[model samples]
Target: MPDNSSYLVVPSSVLWLLGFAVVSISILIIATMVLRARRLRSGMHAAGATEPTGSLLPEFEKNGQSAAASLVQWSPETLRHILAKELPDAQVIVVSNREPYIHNRKGDDIQLVVPASGLVSALEPITRACAGTWIAYGGGSADRLVVDENDRVEVPPDSPSYTLRRVWLSEEEQQGYYLGFANEGLWPLCHIAFTRPIFRASDWESYEAVNRKFADTVVAEARNERPIVLVQDYHFALLPRMIRERLPEAIIITFWHIPWPNSEVFSICPWREKILEGLLGSSIVGFHTQFHCNNFIDSVDRFLESRIEREDSAISYGGQISLVHAYPISIEWPPAHLGKLPDVAQCRRRIREKFGLAEDVKLCVGVERLDYTKGILDRFDALDELLKLHPEWIGKVALLQIAAPSRGTLPAYQQLYEECLHRADDINQRYGREGYTPVLMVTEHYSQVQVYEIYRAADVCMVTSLHDGMNLVAKEFVAARDDEQGVLLLSMFAGASKELLEALIVNPYDAATMGDALLQALTMSQEEQRQRMQRMREIVRDNNVYRWAGSMLLDAARLRKRVAVDRAVGAAPAAPGNVISLLDRKRVAAL
Candidate 1:
């Protein structure tokens, strides 16, 4: 008892020193923890671990350099390597309505024709880089000629790289699915360009059937492993849910390659809720702009009972969270052989001769599919107004409107084509001279080389879309202008208008304003044209198609990783019950 009391009763100075040392040590430990925690959070945020507050645009950094900033120097090999790093054991599969290469019957010989598609140009490199499968509709006459027994062929015949899996649909299926539901219903529904959307029960049934068929093919191709499936456009809006039902673990990404109207506008569809549910099945849904992304999220919030994460731009439904992001698509930059001024000049000469135009005449070129959305009629009206306003340049300026025929079977498209012809005729009749036509309408397909030549030769390139998601024609024109000599008369409605601010943007709906823009483009100084084209070329060259695909892929991978982490932490509950409630409580407590 005496020894214990002596041990307990220490010296006052010694006790004070011990107390000071303990307090100092505790403070040091706490300070170290605070600093370490800050560093950890900063590192996680840099690595895209923390959810973004607004506009969840992917910021990819490599070698301490922004990937997007360095995209101009990156080759397809670099993009492929990045994909391999991001998805180690996963195979990439692309699903779209249009095939990159079409083996069509040209006379007796079957030839491969790469259709004029921005989607093809953008995603083809990704497929080639990953050596993946691109599943598309086999609409070409000789599409079956090139495919192996598995209905798969290595595309871009001369430079075979990736597998092209063609999905053949019956005539009725194509009619109902593509022409009926997709073009008539979803196309008009999405684009708020004053076109009425037509929805029919038969078309809906056909659309569902085609979606199921595609999903089956995708699943069969996926087989044992869960592959990353990238569904393209509105044609397969229902495919995501179908694929999700079959393979819940698969990483599905759907990119809507058009504008998304507001929720009120979108609610006009009879099966809007079903469409929303189907879209939410994806791990991620992408749009071309932030406005479109917001529209999609708002539409989902309005139509479905889902937890909308406004900060992250994600929707949590049925125990899963799907990210919604904007990935503005673009064209391949610095088009091959664009710098061959001698060749371009020769092609221009040939084009002028074929079209019966003088070499000195200022050529305004507009290239687009013959669709109402392209504002072809509006372009003609502008041309008519251009001639009327600028009487001096009646015979000096001509617009070479090369409209590739599209969906000719549809009445709307047919009427559009007819109206364009009538307008062109009226303009030519009113303003044409012996050697010059105000508008030269070429209703036929042109090869890529020819289109590039047109782009290089033109004094002005016009993209007058009523509404579009990244109209690549503008970018293509920009890429082809190696000399930086052409003016871009772009419509304010196009997605490209946001990036190509140097272009003389006009409202296509206003004919008089568009006429003035055309005149301004025609009368622009050579130096001004060069400056504008240079800036636009830089923009296109920097934000090329490769960067677009890479950004989407990186974001999709991050979303999948986040979902996996949530599942591991039991934050993603399968059913709405006590488990979810407990997880929510834990999350709130942790926060």
Candidate 2:
């Protein structure tokens, strides 16, 4: 007992030395922690882990406001750089129903054809920029002939910037999955069109089978396990989850290119749960508008047993979280097909001559697929009413209705075409003189350059969809107008309407109002046209297709880097915030 007391009472010099040593150790630990924190911050910044400011718009974007000039105007070069930084070794793999270029048989020689599809228009630039692989359905007659053993063909025929992998589907599979389920079921179900969605057991089976097949193809085509897969459109709603189940590490960005109806409307689908689950399998689910994003979240909430985080715009389901965001789709700025486009004046002159019209005749154009959802009949009705209300426009204006026939086998579309033709005939008969046709229908598919030429030539471009995602035709009309001369009559229901506010927004359902809008467009002054077109051009230029792709990829990049950082620092996602406790709180409290 005496020895213990003596030991406890140390010498004064020894006590001072012990105290100095303890302080030195404490200082060393603090210095080490400070240095480590600095290093951690630097590493995080280098890894592209931005501070959580809770904003979706990147630094480069600023809503096309004149006060806020874009730091980076998105281009092919910028997109390539973004891909290099964000994705590094991983290539972008696009899963789509339509190919950028299709091989068709013309006699014995195989000819390449670019499909006249909005989906193609939106995605081709990204594929070309990244030199990435496009996985699409091989519907072409000679698609099998052009591809190598891997069913891969270098596209754009002449330049060959990217490879297109063809996935073959049998007739039965195509009919059931594409025509029956996708076109008939999902298209009508999603669109505000009056047609009813036809869901068959056979079609659902084929849809599932096709999605599974595409997923398997995607997995095989992936350069790495964690490839950036962009699942495109309603054609492949089940694809994201199918890809997810196979390649758990893959980052899937599923873009719903069509308008996502409200939850009440979405409940019309019989297999709504499956669709919601499939979409939630994605890392990010992109829509054309915030309204659509809300609709999607509402749908998921209504149908699924998922954790909804509205503040974060995220859904946690099946041990994973999916972020739902609106990335308004757009056409390419200085579109890829602008290489050989004639000057605007020349385009107008040529188009007037092509249509056998006088220079004074106002050229109004409508470019879309011949689908009921496009409101082609409504456009014709509007024109009919326009001529009736103002008979002066009867012979003075021409609506060059250029429509590529789509889903022709469907009764709704076939009926729409007939109705459109009859309506066009009635308008032409009632209005047209010897050489003036008010409604001229071009039913054949036109190439991108051809469509651009049309867009450039028009005095007015009518994108009167009853319900639409971001109508690229509206953007295309804006993008094509270097002269800033045309008027864009966009439907209020179109997602582009919300962005292109300068456009004469009209409800496609209201033919009388649209007729008046058409009249107003025809009567709009050149100065007013310039102001509106200039503003729209700015919007389209600032928010082009590359920006759309870049924005989503940037988000993906942040998410990827965060996951990597968490894993590297042994940060458990399930743990509380600030998981890495370099200084033990319990020890500090005891001290």
> Going through the candidates in order, what is the number of backbone clashes in each?
0, 0
Q: What is the lDDT of residue 582 in candidate 1?
A: 28
Q: Candidates' TM-scores?
A: 0.86, 0.86
Which run of 10 residues does model 2 get worst, by summed lDDT? 574-583
Model 2 TM-score, 2 decimals: 0.86
- Model 2 lDDT per residue over 488-538, tens place: 999988888877889999999999999999999999999999999998888
Runs in model 1 lying further than 4 Å from the true structure: 1-72, 337-343, 563-590
Please, what is the whole-model Cα lDDT of each candidate in the order they appear? Answer: 0.80, 0.82
Off by over 4 Å in 2: 1-70, 572-591
